[model samples]
Target: MTPQQRRALDFIEQYYADRRIAPSLKEIAAHLGTKSRTRAHEAVAALVRDGHLVKTHGGRRNIAPAQIQLDRFTTAALRAELQRRETAHG
Candidate 1:
């Protein structure tokens, strides 16, 4: 990732950590010191493409960090639940 993109991703992760929600493109643009939201959008798209971020469709605040670190206990519990399920599900 480019330095600019890394900064954007860091800001996004921090925003989500503080508010439990993703910031809007305008917020990202403001942090990035650019009036054009298109630049922010492009950075987000690149991050998503590189698997550093995830974005759900049809929402203004859908972007989030993709590699959220989980505690070992929580990871184990999630794995157990998945094993119990009959079919693979997202």
Candidate 2:
């Protein structure tokens, strides 16, 4: 993920964890210390483009992680691949 996409995902995750609800673009921008909601929206759009997130019901505040139907093997493979990538780049 690009830095912006990663930041967007991090913001969404934190927002959900904190509020138990999806945040609006304005809220996200505030959380990210951005001056404009447009920047937050662009970051969210990038996340959707990368398949890490889904926008729901044609709304700006309704976003969720992409649905994944993973079997144990597939889940493990994905986890390992993500770890490998993180380790390689970090």
Candidate 3:
């Protein structure tokens, strides 16, 4: 990840940690000291592409970290991943 992408991801993770909700594009822009929500979105899109974040459709606060805590994997998440893999390979 680029330096700016890392910064955006850190801000996003911190925001979610504090509120248990993802930050909006506008909020992310302001935190990055920019007024352009599009720029903030691009940063977020990059993070999503790089697998540092995930975005679900049809919701205002749908973005989440692919892993809640990078260091520790949760059992439920592991099960979900295993199910997805099984479905995909079957």
What are the models' TM-scores? Answer: 0.73, 0.61, 0.72
Model 2: ten consecutive residues of lowest lDDT:
67-76
> lDDT of all the models against the reference?
0.82, 0.73, 0.83
Q: Cα deviation in Å at residue 62, candidate 3?
A: 1.5
* Model 1 regions more than 4 Å off: 69-90
Top of the candidates by TM-score = 1
Error of 1 at 45 (Å): 0.2
Q: Clash pairs of candidate 1?
A: none
Q: Model 2, stretches more than 4 Å misplaced?
A: 58-60, 67-90
In TM-score terms, candidate 1 sits at 0.73
Model 3, residue 53: displacement in angstroms? 0.3
Clashes of each: 0, 0, 0
By lDDT, the candidates rank as 3, 1, 2
Q: What tens digits encode model 2's per-residue C-alpha lDDT throughout 1-90?
A: 777667778778666645545788887788778879888888888888888788778644788767433332355666776899999999
- Residues 1-90 of candidate 3: C-alpha lDDT, one tens digit per residue: 888788888888878766668999999999889999999989998999989999877678789987786434456756777899999999
